[model samples]
Target chain A: MSPVSTSASRLVYDALKSCGVRLMSALPETWLVHLIGLAEADPDMTLVRLAKEEEGVGISAGAHLAGVKSAMLMQNHGFLASINGIVSCAQLYRIPLLMLVSYRGEFGERDPWQTEGGGVTEDLLRALRIPFARLENPSHVSHRIAKAQTLAHSANKPVALLLCRDLMWEEQT
Target chain B: MRRLDALRAVYSQLEGRIVVTIMGAVAAELQSIGHRPNFFYLQHAMGLASSLGLGIALSRPDRQVVVFDGDGSVLMNLGGLTTLARYRPRNLVHVVFDNESLLSVGGFPTATSTGSDLAGIAAAAGVPRTQTVRSIDEFTHAFDEALAAEDLTTLVAKVEPVGPSAYVTDLSLLENRFQFQRYLKESRTTR
Candidate 1:
């Protein structure tokens, strides 16, 4: 039997396309690996992998300024590194920046390092004052993604869509 | 003519436009000269300036966006040209400062040494209008004309090799960041 498609990925892709997102700056991580694949498969979307998390934010900010809709995909840990770019460039310029973040340590995650990032992910975003949504079901993905995009666009600010690992991978096993 | 002169010419002609500057000395200069809050300094991203500009332009179609690009940065992601061509933003102006070397990260030769025609490449990549300027006067004319044109345009300015100016104010990374956060907050509350 074929694997069940993750509607989350489709919703994200559609939100990206509908909003005319042309580029995505990302890093390889398990949580967002699927979104990266979808971005690669779509010709309309250009996937830009950065050497560092900070670079991802800067690149996305620049792309957004040049008339391309872009998203910065990274883990919560990486989000810390991107704060400078997000605040200095994106927020300062009133550039719309969408962050697709993975909740690292949620669901009794075994990795110690991941737990550190996961523990502070929500608070970190809160500290940054970037409103976010914890994505639970694929059904709600489209509306939430759209809402985040609208908030970012209208406010020229950054918004996060946090995806917990358990919510996405729990049923697979 | 100085790099600032070329930039000033472009800036003077553009009214209420968002200009995105990539990391490096060029960005600092533009920002120092009173660029709008929409001015994005790529700080460390190197080459993705045009792509970022593309995103902003697409999202806010009502705003005219210009990307101040460096030759080294452009070469790093030449493939981005194809993406730009594909989308073809009408209000997008891609101004490439072709100094023939990576002046920002120490002077290093670029792909242009092997006869990389940046303008030709941009044309092939699908930018509707691609022009090259060798001097400040020429650039000023071209810059003004590009603003008037209603299509995706790429203007390559073969600027003289110059480093960052000495009189510029150096805003710490953290400080600039706070400024931006404040910008978002202020704008949000006002709106």
Candidate 2:
């Protein structure tokens, strides 16, 4: 992990904590490794490591039902994989779900395997009518996350904050 | 044994516990028995009730969370079993009704129809406790024990492939969500 990436991860983690996110569900992915690590180390936060991304949807719903704020951290592919739960469970049940998706396969993509899912990430989010915002600049991280969370709670629907490479990765210098 | 009978045998035991039922037959049948504020019928989303229960269990360790799931739904998200095992919330009781078919959406046979052992799979997934019961007596006993214990337990109840006459419930999805959420909040305050 680059120093800048680790710093960015801390900024995002702090922002989530500030929003009163007590629980988080995630599966191991490159961009989210540090964020997951931070969650694991925090005794105040409960980290539910998921076998698949879709399970996080249900986890977040259950958390909301229990009157606890929670978040989901996953790669863009994970967001795509979780469409069923996002639509049927979160949307149908009117649960506010805050998902921080690691945006891969955009503009400067390395791995060919990621491009397919990344390519369709925005289109699918639009199709689902799931409101989303991009988080690329470090300075905008806290404000963007807080606003996304507020929208999710107010609308009682699934909202996404895409963690772009600019925010998640620092050029290897 | 029939699914309704299995549910009925354990109905009284579910009084104070938070219950989450999967979509379709399980939800419909549970509703037929009677409705409770603590019950959340996860309507459209199949195969994620266990995950939901896990979240509730973890969030409210003071409350017991029980998930009523189906074989088809379980098979749809087998990875959930492993995730449940990973967390191992002591307050969670996962009860899978294996009817060997998707009784809600026509009579399409599921993987369990051939020879998939859900209990065996759950044990392999590292859930603290697991059991498979074929008779109502066995199911009731296992359920009672699971509720009594503080370990995460997965009970697979084998039942006949039969469902209620209708799958519709009078409760809307949003209504159920609010009712359940309100129940959780009130329960917390009273405690």
Candidate 3:
């Protein structure tokens, strides 16, 4: 529940804006609450506090169909919850969606529940045939997000920008 | 009233507005009634028609968005209702075809069949407006009010359980999606 730095949120927001993301449907991460706050405060972006990650996928896909570029911000568990909707709606329809997923189980010692999701995240993404790039270092934040958005928009597929443990929370065990 | 009659009644009122229909017989019936470029027929996705409609409505505030959903699909993603209510897009109109059974999947009873009030659930979930219409006249009045108003509304149309509907679509899902987007673009330009 520690407050992640505002800088990380700012960097991601700038990158997403650069990619022409106007609507964001997010399932809040405790470490990324400030990111949601940033999206909410910005007048250019319509922030939807989604009930679940699957709902965000559907909403983002719908927004894309209407010519509005949209993104989803959530943790790995939410990503897992969104698999069916993302695959069925986004993948089947070929709508580009930028998913900013905070990696919960990647690296360092963590909770039991998070361990499984962290371990299986990459495999799950591959199983769904979704292209993804992991951002383990803060330095790659801007370029990686921009690249992910470009690939998603150009290919009309859901691409992932995985924010690993260090980039998510400031303090690590 | 029969599901077909209920759908026909609503379809006449939609005009040029954007429509997203649930999968199975509901979508089949919608296609059978008449096809429009503005209408989106979800082929495989069970519960995301409303979510898609909400997204488009939010993105295109100037355009009215309508969702034609079924009870089984609504039960699958009640959270869509909460999300819709939370965002409260004024241009969104959600109408659920409540046959109380999974008529799309062989008429197995859904929770609604055993007495779950979807309108009450939607209202409890925070949608500004909610109504349940049993007759054609009731549905017409309720839908007209919803279409004319700015607040988000949900109408649960109770219809009799029916057998499998067998209307096949001439176009594919991708074609429908592309055409619908083009229609939205045209709508924006004409506006």
Candidate 4:
């Protein structure tokens, strides 16, 4: 029995690949563990393990400059931490950045520390003017990811897809 | 050595390489020398120049990526050093101009002012090659070697805490980005 939501993780990873995301930068988090593992094992992909989340912003921007499609994978807390980079670098420079954020600490969240960040995630995204969508249903994962990536590139702005608990949790019965 | 003089010493060597300079004196001074399509002056990003360079290096393995950073910016994101070492792109060169102060913002001292050895830190962080130079000759030598070698290198140059008089540039952020992307695309096709 695996701890991660294996089927959902595969769905998200395949969607990213279909969207031509060859490079991914991430910092370790529980919800993103399986996705990160999949990225690491894929030889065709480049996985940059960042020490902090904001670094991924710069990495994605650089990849954009070099004509490589890239994405950033992190938790909601990481998204909050990376707001500075997102605003100052990505937005100011108009880089097309795709961010896949694990929406932790919403409903059914047991961790007290994660709740504050989760609570403010959508509000902050709104404040920043970064359009985002929630991936709560497994059936909507692929289309949402593809749409978000297209929006990012077409609009030349930072767009996010929030991976909700319903789409990223596996219940053991 | 003066920052501008050191830049002049190696300006020609940067002809074909992709250069990413942090926001401040380094970008202004480099632009004053000459602006090229391959040069991306990261205007507002203070501490992510190295990360940007790493991305370009990893994405375009055929091209060499050089980052011009400052003491304050590098100190702000020391974790960047560890990340660079972890991947260790062969075509990446990180050059930190250790003026020991945030010269562009104000004459405030940074961690390097009290003897934080950036080259030593990078070496400890597992970067394959690292060097510290104080003179223009040494800087040029180390930079030339770093660019020529097939391994990741971090070169920290100690200099006086001084910068250009003004921080203005005519190039807009969007314009620079498009020009850079176009340059990369054209160069790839030409090669």
Which 10-residue span in candidate 4 chain A carries the lowest summed lDDT?
A164-173
CAPRI-style grade of the A/B interface in model 1: incorrect
lDDT of 4 by residue, A1-173 (tens): 66569889999999999999999999989888889999999999999999999999999999998989999999988998898899989999999999999998898887888878888999999999999999988999999999999999899999999999888987554
Worst 10 residues of 1 chain A by lDDT: A1-10
Candidates' C-alpha lDDT:
0.73, 0.92, 0.86, 0.92
- Tell me the tens digit of each residue's lDDT in model 1 across B1-191: 56777877677655556666667768777766665554556665555567667656655566677888988888866867877787688999999988888776677888876789999999997899999888888998888788889688999988777867552456654455445445434543554
For each candidate, the DockQ is 0.18, 0.87, 0.80, 0.87
| Off by more than 4 A, model 1 | A1-173, B31-38, B165-168, B172-191
Candidate 2 per-residue lDDT over residues B99-146, each given as its tens digit: 999887789899988999999999999999999999988899889999
Candidate 2, residues A60-170, lDDT tens digits: the string is 999989989999999999998899999999998889999999999997778899888888999999999999999999999999999999999999999999999888888
TM-scores for every candidate against the unseen true structure: 0.61, 0.98, 0.96, 0.98
Residue B122 displacement (Å), model 3? 0.7
- TM-score per candidate for chain A alone: 0.89, 0.97, 0.94, 0.97
- Sort order, DockQ high to low: 2, 4, 3, 1
Model 2: residues with Cα > 4 Å off, grouped in runs? A1-4
* TM-score between candidate 2 chain A and the true chain A: 0.97
